[model samples]
Target: MATKKTQILILPYPIQGHINPMLQFAKRLASKSRHLILTLLLPTSHARSISSHIGSINVQPISDGADQQGQQFQTAETYLQQFQRAVPGSLDDLIRLERGHDQPQPTILIYDSFFPWALDVAHSNGLAAAPFFTQTCSVSSVYFLFKEGRLSDEMELPHGIPRLEQRDLPSFIQDKENSAHLLELLVDQFSNLDEADYVFFNTFDKLENQMVEWMARQWQVLTVGPTIPSMYLDKCVKDDRSYGLNLFKPNRESCRDWLCERRASSVIYVSFGSMAILKQEQIEEIAKCLENLQTRFIWVVRETEMAKLPSEFVEWNLSSGLGLVVTWCNQLDILAHETVGCFVTHCGWNSVLEALCLGVPMVGVPNWSDQPTNAKFVEDVWKVGVRAKEDEDGIVKSMVLEKCVRAVLEGEKGEVVRRNAGKIKRWALEAVQLGGSSDNNIAKFVTGLALKD
Candidate 1:
């Protein structure tokens, strides 16, 4: 019999945040001294961007023949069905193709937690399939909590519970109807987790021990994050680096140059993430709030127009030259810049990690989904940021936003938060160093799977 070759293939869910950590994992595995070939499967939209970042690896785009028009699919079911149709036999086809090549066929398949179909594909082919949970371990634990019926009633309570209660629960679980559907899906999916050869979390063990212990009891779970080391290694091997999904034009250099001109620890960087849609009134509120602070600010607003703000407010900011607004900014580069003292963010996991890694304090205004939970982690557990309060109308009021921003930027509390953020940044860097928690976990994960084969 011919010797089976060792290869690893990564399939990430078709979203920006989901794709990033998986790409980091692939990059790490590719750097290993072992002779394992690595392949990354991404949406066509992500392939070009991911391709530009790494070399000597194959980026396979799954082409779902849906109309390329701007029509969006709202639910996961519809999106998965569309992709299934477009990439009908692609997974199996890829396996067969690898086997026919002079090189080895893939021995392990690592896929996003949301892509359950990859689990079935791996099982049928007798290959190890590891599920990568892209969110923090706390978020994943809360998910399993809801699955186990521990979080249902507490989630329904109106108010006055501890911040941990609200934050630990997944954001979708807050809505009764959506939570019902989400719980059902989670239960069904989690039941199959035991069959998975290994489960990978993009977090460090020191962050969420309770959840990590729970997950490990059921399946072999590894805590290998914040995934920055892998990304840094990938960058070291390349001379040219690219940013953003290849779709939008990037303004990274401009944002960095603007930061260069500002005083140290003076600029507040604001971004609502890639998918948040703020109403006109909300935009006006935030714009006015920034004006009230009179601080140097760089805000990334993705909308085509900004008619919501008062004309006077815009004029004052423009005249003072204290604020620069762009439709989109290069977030990573901006966060890493030394002059950026604070981040007013939507609390996406990737943004949270980036800010923590760079030791920048945050003012979290969570919009939707996992953001609320992520925001809670930043403020409650990490002590590196504060949460902005929403008004009676459920929108974050301008005054409250301003207060939070100023508190994080200039107040005495701001200094303490910044110091703590610096501590966390050191921890993040150490986690990815040689023989660190993240490094050991990845090595053990790969070796365990290899032995299984």
Candidate 2:
């Protein structure tokens, strides 16, 4: 008798952070057994760019309603309006086609919490649904708390996940500028979570133990992450080193050899992820500080943002040999390099997890979203990094940048930060190793998928 294969459908919000972790988890599940078939549902704008990278998964494009180029949409409101209207119908039709064909019926849909509409699609068709939250457990805990009607004018968390002021609320709920729909949507995502049979978080028990404990008191929350490449964690599968998901082409060829020239723990690696676009003055400030610090550094700046820099900045840095600047590089590969002494980041949770696993300390310059909360944890709770302070204009000037950089890379405080970062790194590795919490949870989830009728 032939055994039935578990068909898994993944639907990630079309963003780099959301896509990377989800794809990596897909690869992880595929590696578990040949009996699992992987499929990804992406918007038309992202489907082609990401399809070729995922080797084993079947890529299906769901209509997003605007031109394929995505030029017509500019703001989040406009894009969400289009996506919400387009996704359910396009996705329903695709499911019907799959059911009518030779393919196995999909058993479950794993989707990012931001796009709860996917849940309705799954339920309408009698498919099991799982909510895969891409946010750090700490940030999501804050959101969940707010959803419970526990948050009002009280900016400080009573349980103390991390010290957060009114300004540090989740980006959508923070200010007068936040859209009403966005705020309500975030709350509704948590409310809709009751429909999910299984919930997954892209975090590990050791990294955010308090937050994990808090959530477990209410519902079963599985911590199966720091969802990095399998190569870094279990080394369970061949050719699993890359997430195979990059919105921008990485320039690793230019960096591999250059990093070898620098001494150990001497270089500052700076990247603000794919979405942050710094003001021209902010770019100039960072460049001038990098030059004056006289430290070897590697900075990732897209070509589109070059105009924001001082004229000849690229040519001058190339000739000066003081640093290396490129459009992009394989971030994990670069961060894992021994020469990367410190990371200057926007404190995005994915970057934070990567750096923590690599034992790299940080100088956090938060821009928005959950970044401020992540930055606070980096500085206050973990003691693994220092948060760069911004002025009234919200600019982290050159001197402030230099001060924070030196504190993490050169000052007495840096010693403790490095030691603490190393400790966190060990804990992160332990969580994903054999018999670890994440390893056990992943195995349990896989088994549950096969058994669920």
Candidate 3:
């Protein structure tokens, strides 16, 4: 007789970074157990991108009171407010309907940590709540600390957590202008995490061992990541590289072909992830740094945010072989490419883990949020990257950008950075291999998760 399918319901916070890992885990879980049925609750607009990546899995798009065409709000704050208000009803309807179905009722709801509201929804519906964190376990711990009012400038944070000044948190929480409206959301992310029956982190033991240990002290946390594509982790799965989820339609060939022509480890890969909007002066400064370096570079700039660039510099780069600026590209493919040397990134946790696993040295130009803390770890703790210094105005000047880039590529420190990145990659590969800590943790979670009889 066949076993009943474990209907696992997953709800990711509506963003590419959050969705990608949760979806990857869903795929991983499905691949590991044939006796499982997976359903994802995604924003209606994002459903296509997700379906394209993992079409075999079940996906039910939730209407966030937005257009059905996938268009999202211009700002995160407004989007979160609207999304939080719109999602509870859809969740209630789906869980209620699924529980009454002929198949086994949904066993559990794995919701992103950012949407702590998911726990309340899970509680109301009698579903087990599992909070899945897409950020670094270290960052997740820090957020929980922030929520408890346990963090202060004078207090020394625990080991493995970045010793950040109170002002160094995400811009929405620390910056006077942005934080005023969105600060509460930052706290809310961790508020409900503890109430979860199972807590998940897209990280592994040894990667952030101290943080993982500390996090488990309060709640039994499971480390089940670098929750990335199986291909990158050297799993023996075909077509596993295409996570098939991108908010932007990436032109991979153009970027891949461009990367091929560049000398090995000579290209500077620069991206600020999906959300950061750089000031015009910052953009111009970066332009000058690229021009001054005279090396091959690829920069991902959003189309709407392109106006921040100096028109003269933009036109000049169009003609110069020094840089290639596209709105978006397959970031993982680019990182894996041999020609790419150093990454200049915004230090989003996914990007941080990706760079580490790939063994690419970094020039961290952190903007806001956990980025500063991640940057500190990259430079001070991991010894795999250098953090670029910004001026008093909070913009990394052209000179600082130039120096950090050069340091990672040619300076005396480059050798050590490369060596450390190489060392970490080896450990990361080991962690994801068969019976590795990450692999075991995920397998353990799968075997133990069950539904009410």
Candidate 4:
């Protein structure tokens, strides 16, 4: 007779950027082992979006105090407080209920690093805990150093990591005074990490070998990512084209038609991920930059953000036949398109990985969080893209944005960026394929669990 399967539970912070990567990981874990049962536990608000698209992995809704309120919390701090207060009780109840069921009880708790409290819940219930980090290892290293009080005033970083000035640090640390709550949240990720069985980051080994090596010295670090759907990478997982969850329903058909009409490597694609709310002035500057380029472009201006765009910009673009200003679209689809040349992005980790995995060069206009650090690596370390410089007032002017885009899309610098992008893209693909670095790491995790069982 076959032995019982190991039951695993995953909990991600309830946001698009966080949920998608962790969900993809759940999918991959399920594919790797028949002896593992994976369940994704999301807050009620986020779990409502779960549907047929996510196969095999069970999705369960837990309370975050939003079910009764029937709306989002007004502030990040408030949301965190409520989620922390509510989720632990719900998780304990769920684990108890599962223990009474006929199936295997959850043996592992894979949680977002943001909620160190979950590790406590796991230990209380006799489960091994793993923390999933959705950011690059470089950014994580800075936070770890800061948390340990080892980061120096002069920014003397670890050996394998590049030296960074204050500005190159994650924005939360750079403006710690104004962003106290957020800075605390990020640094707190390391507080209970030592107790975790495994620490996972959504980055490949080749992309940050030194940083990953530095991080591994302290924890069971594993790099099992790109974490994008397999169809975009190795195609080993059948028909896995989408991330299976989106906060916004994309205008897929229109976006695909528009890109198909453009010439090869001739269109500019622009998007800032879900949460970034650019100031009206910054939006106008970006509008001006796109207008100045006079090339085919597709811009994703979320419905809420559309009001900040220059009045009649959409109408003007439509009439000029030079751009498509969409509310939201399948970003991976856009990046994978041959007509797309460069990505103008907010440099969110997920967006950066998608662009890198798809071999698209970028002009990074990072706004906040880990974006600035990711942008720095894009230009200085990866050499696969250029970061658009901002003016004294901390805004990227139209001319500066135009010049950055031009450098990535034309001339010798463009060639170098594209070539580097192509080279890294190949590495990204290899990392996810069978016997590749990331794949091996994933296999190790599965095998380790089996050996323990």
Best-fitting candidate, measured by TM-score?
A: 4
Which model, 1 or 4, shows the larger lDDT?
4
lDDT digits (tens) for residues 1-453 of candidate 1: 643447788887776677767777776666653566678777664464555335545677655544454357887667766676655367767766776888777887898887667788887877788899888766766667667777654454212223365444556776758566555554455767878888898887666666677667778898888765344322432322332233456686778788899888989888887777787778888888888888899988775555555788778888999988887776777877888999999998888988887899999988877788888878877889999877656588889999898888877989889999989887877777777777788788767656766
lDDT of each: 0.74, 0.83, 0.82, 0.90
User: Sorted by lDDT, highest first, which candidate order results?
Assistant: 4, 2, 3, 1
Clash list (residue pairs), candidate 3: 45-70, 170-369, 172-179
TM-score for candidate 1:
0.88
lDDT of 3 by residue, 110-157 (tens): 998777888888888888899887877777666667677786787878
Give the Cα error of residue 230 in candidate 4, in Å.
0.2
After the best TM-score superposition of candidate 4, give how far the Cα of residue 96 lies from its true spot, in angstroms.
1.6
On a 0 to 100 scale, what is the lDDT of residue 68 in model 3? 45
Candidate 4's residue-wise lDDT over 15-90, tens digit each? Answer: 8999999989988888898888888898887777676337777888888878878877788678888888889999
Question: lDDT by residue for model 2 over 123-150, one digit each (tens)?
Answer: 8987888889888877887777778877
- lDDT at position 329, candidate 1: 72
Total clashing pairs for each candidate? 0, 0, 3, 0
For each of the candidates, the C-alpha root-mean-square deviation to the true structure, in angstroms, is 3.9, 2.0, 2.3, 1.4
Please provide TM-scores, in order, for all candidate models, with all chains considered together: 0.88, 0.94, 0.94, 0.97
Question: Candidate 4 — which residues are off by over 4 angstroms?
Answer: 69-72, 153-155
